[model samples]
Target: MRIGVLGTGGMAAALGGAWARAGHEVFVGGRDGAAAEALARRIGGAGHGTPARAAEYGEVALLAVPAGAAPALAEEHAAALAGRTVVDCTNPLAPGPDGVMLTTRAGESVAGRIQAAAPGAHVVKAFNLVHASVWDLPAGAFGETPPAVPFCADDAHAAERVAGLITAMGWSPMPAGGLDRAVYVEATAAFVIGVWWAGGSPRLAFPEPAHPSA
Candidate 1:
């Protein structure tokens, strides 16, 4: 698979590196040319260029920029991103007095905003729940079985393709209905982040369920 990553940040570096290691052709691009090039080299990506060019080069474009910057970047590359499967890995979280808060309009999610910015692109919301550093770990960052990655998107084909990619990366893919449900996922991130910051183990609440013998 050919993937284009838009950013020079941690998410871009980690996920892009993982994809490259999985034998995907990756191209990285960012506002900072040197940083983008450096990241591309580190990931052994096929190429590096401006964000617009990277969008054009991908069958699946990964928007790994900051959440606040995601919509603008998508809008700026709308033309190049048309009809492409664009994966949004941004979390619209802002620091609050106590913990993190999801920063969105009354009912909008960051993924929805990015989709609106590039109306022609199939934007899927994913990778927002885990920290970027987790991608640096082996296939299953947790213990034995890999944690499921929940995603939402309106385009079924595009969503399935992205889900397949996630499976290839050794994580379970959980389809979380259509695009509208993405807000819930984003909100969960805010809550989980708060728990993590508060020194609580959120994962404890989601223990492995016992299964009946077949």
Candidate 2:
């Protein structure tokens, strides 16, 4: 798969590296062309000038930028992303002295906002629950087993493709249903953030259920 990662941050680096390792073509883009090139060099992928170019070059475009920047970015790449699957990995994180709060409402989600901006794109909400460190580890780093990463999207085919990509990254993919369910998933991100605050650990993961015997 040709994947375009739009961000030069830790999460973008982690995921882009993993996808490159998995034999996929990846193009990373950012505001600064030099920084994007540096990130691509580090991840062994190509780098592009603008988000629109990256979106045009990829079969699936992963938006790993800050959540607040999503709408504008989506709008910028709307034409390029037409009829494409866009995997949204952003969380509506509102930061302040008090800490981070959910910027999205109880019934709305970042994925939906991006979808609204690019109505032609199939937006799937995922990878927001896990830490960037988890994506940096090897496939067997979590022992012989690993945890599940839950996601949701309105389009079934797009969701399935994204799920396969998620599995290839050494994590189990738990489909949490339609895109509307992203509201709950975003809420869960807040829940996970709370847990991290209380436990003082940002490396925790949600356990996957074992398969039943046939």
Candidate 3:
């Protein structure tokens, strides 16, 4: 798959590296072209001038920028993203006295906003519940083995594609449901954040389901 990643952050770099390692063609784009190029070099992928260029280069695009920046990025790359599958990997986190706060409403989410802005694009929510660090860990980085990462999307094909990509990175993929299910996914992210803060470790991941007895 020719994948494009918009955002020069840790999450973007992590996913880009995973895809590149999985033998997928990946192009990374950011506000700083140089930084994006550097990341691509580190990740063994390609880099682009802007978000639009990255979107244009990819059959599928991953929007891994800040939740606040998601809508603007979608609008800026609307032309490029038209008729393409877009995987959303952002969390609407707001600064608060205690900790980060979720900025999305009960009915709305960042993925929904991106879909609304780029109506022609197939926007799917994913990668919002895990930390970037988890993506780089070796297989069995956790205890006995690695666990599945849960994600959701409205578009079944897009969801399957992203889920396959996730599995290629040496982790299992658990599909939670459609786009509206993003609310639960984002809330789970907040819960994960709390658990990390309390435990002081980011290496932990959610456990996968056990097989049922016959």
Candidate 4:
């Protein structure tokens, strides 16, 4: 698989490095050409270039930029991104006096906006729940069991492709319905961020909500 990473940030480096280690070709792109090239070398990427070039180089592209910048980046490379699977790992959250605040409007997720920006691309919301440091761990990152990552996508094929990538990177893919449900995933990220900020464990909050009676 050829993967393109559209940022030089932590998330971008983590995922790109994992995929590269899995024997997939990768390209790291960023606004700063030098930073992109440095990240590419660090991650064993096949190449490095501008975001547009990254979009053109891969069958699967990961948008790990800031949430506010995702739309413009997507729009700028819409032509190259068309007909490709685009994975969104952005969380629209900022630290506030109270806790983390969601930057997106009600009912609108960063992934959704990115989809609108590049209407022809298959936008899948994923890799937003966990911290980038977690992705740096080996196959069994979470002690005995690998963590499950919930993703939402309107395109079944694209979803499956992204799921495969997630699995390759050592995570269990939990499909959270279609793209319409993506806002929920984004909200989950916000909630999780708040929990971390408050020094609480988000994992403890997620259990079998209710077990069915046998």
Candidate 5:
């Protein structure tokens, strides 16, 4: 599989490196050409270049940029992404008066906005539930069974392809639902981040024995 990474941040480095290590052809692209080239070298990626060029180079385009920038970038590469698999790993969380909040408009998710911007792309929401450091480790390090990576997508072929890529990391790919379920997943990430910011483990509420995959 060929993957085009669209950022130079932690998520891009971590997941892109994992994919490259899994024998997928990876191309990195960013606003900063030097940084993109550096990351490409560090991750064993096949090449590096402008985001639009990278978008055109791969079967799958991994949108690892900041949530606020995702839609515009998708719009910029809409033509390249047409009929291709687009994997969205962004979480639109921001600080609010009360606490952490999902930054997207009510009833709309980050993935939905990306889908709207690149109408022809098969968008899938994933890799937002956990921190990038979690992906930095080997999948088997967690436990006997690899952790399940839950995701949502509107297109079946896109979902299956993305699920196969997720499984290549040795993790279980749990399909949550269609694109409509993305809002829930994003909200959960926001809540989970808020608890972590407050110095609490969101996982503490649900014991492993009862909620193994939570």
Candidate 6:
């Protein structure tokens, strides 16, 4: 599988490196050509160039840029992204008067906005739950059981393909629902971020929700 990474930041390096180790071809791209080239070398990528070129170079494109910048980036590469699969790992968490909150507009997630920006691209929301450092750890660093990655995509084929990439990177893909549900996914990220800020374990609050079996 060929993957295009659209950022030179930590998240891009971590996930891109993992895929490269999994034997997938990775092409890293960024505004800073030097940084992109360096990351590609570090990850043993197939090549490096501008984001537009990377968008056109891969079967899957990973948008790991800041949430605030994603829409513009997506719009800029809309032509290259058409008929392509886009994996969104951006979280729009920002400080609020109350606590950690999603920076997105009501009912609009970063992924959703990206989809709107590049209407022809099949956008899938994923890889937003954990810190970039988590991806840097060796597989099974958490334990014998692999971690679960909850993702959402309206396109079934795109979901299946992204799930394959997620699996290749050593995670269990938990398909939450369609792109319509991505707002909730982004909320979950905010919730987990709040938990971490409070020094609580977010993992303890997942799956098998508490309810009376009546």
Best by lDDT: 5
Over 132-188, each residue of candidate 5 has an lDDT whose tens digit, in order, gives 998889868888988878899999999999999989998899999999899999999
Stretches of candidate 1 above 4 Å error?
208-214
Candidate 5 minimal-lDDT segment of 10 residues = 205-214
Could you tell me every candidate's TM-score relative to the true structure?
Answer: 0.94, 0.89, 0.88, 0.95, 0.95, 0.94
- TM-score (C-alpha, index-matched) for candidate 5: 0.95
Clashes of 2: 0
What do the candidate models score in CA lDDT, each in turn? 0.90, 0.84, 0.82, 0.90, 0.92, 0.90
Q: What lDDT tens digits, residue by residue, belong to model 1 across residues 35-63? A: 98999889974599899888998799999
Candidate order by decreasing lDDT: 5, 6, 4, 1, 2, 3
lDDT of 4: 0.90
- TM-score: model 3 vs. ground truth: 0.88
**How much lDDT does candidate 3 score?**
0.82
Q: In candidate 4, what are the lDDT values of residues 112-201, reduced to their tens digit?
A: 999999999999999899889888889985777777889999998899998898899788899998887889998888899899878999
Model 6: worst 10 consecutive residues (lDDT sum) = 205-214
Give the clashing pairs for model 6.
none
**Candidate 6 residue lDDT tens string, 1-214:** 8889999999999999988888898999899999999998988745899998889987899998999999899999999999889999999998887779888889899898999999999999999999998887777777877888999999988999888987887789999999989999999999999989888999788657377574
Winner on TM-score (4 vs 6):
4
Across residues 49-141, which tens digit of lDDT does each residue of candidate 2 receive? 666678898789999898989878998889998888998888887654666678877688888889999999999999888788878888878
Comparing 3 with 4 on lDDT, the higher-scoring candidate is 4
Query: Candidate 2: which stretches are off by over 4 Å?
Result: 95-100, 200-214
Better of 2 and 4 by TM-score: 4
Candidate 6 lDDT at 171 equals 85
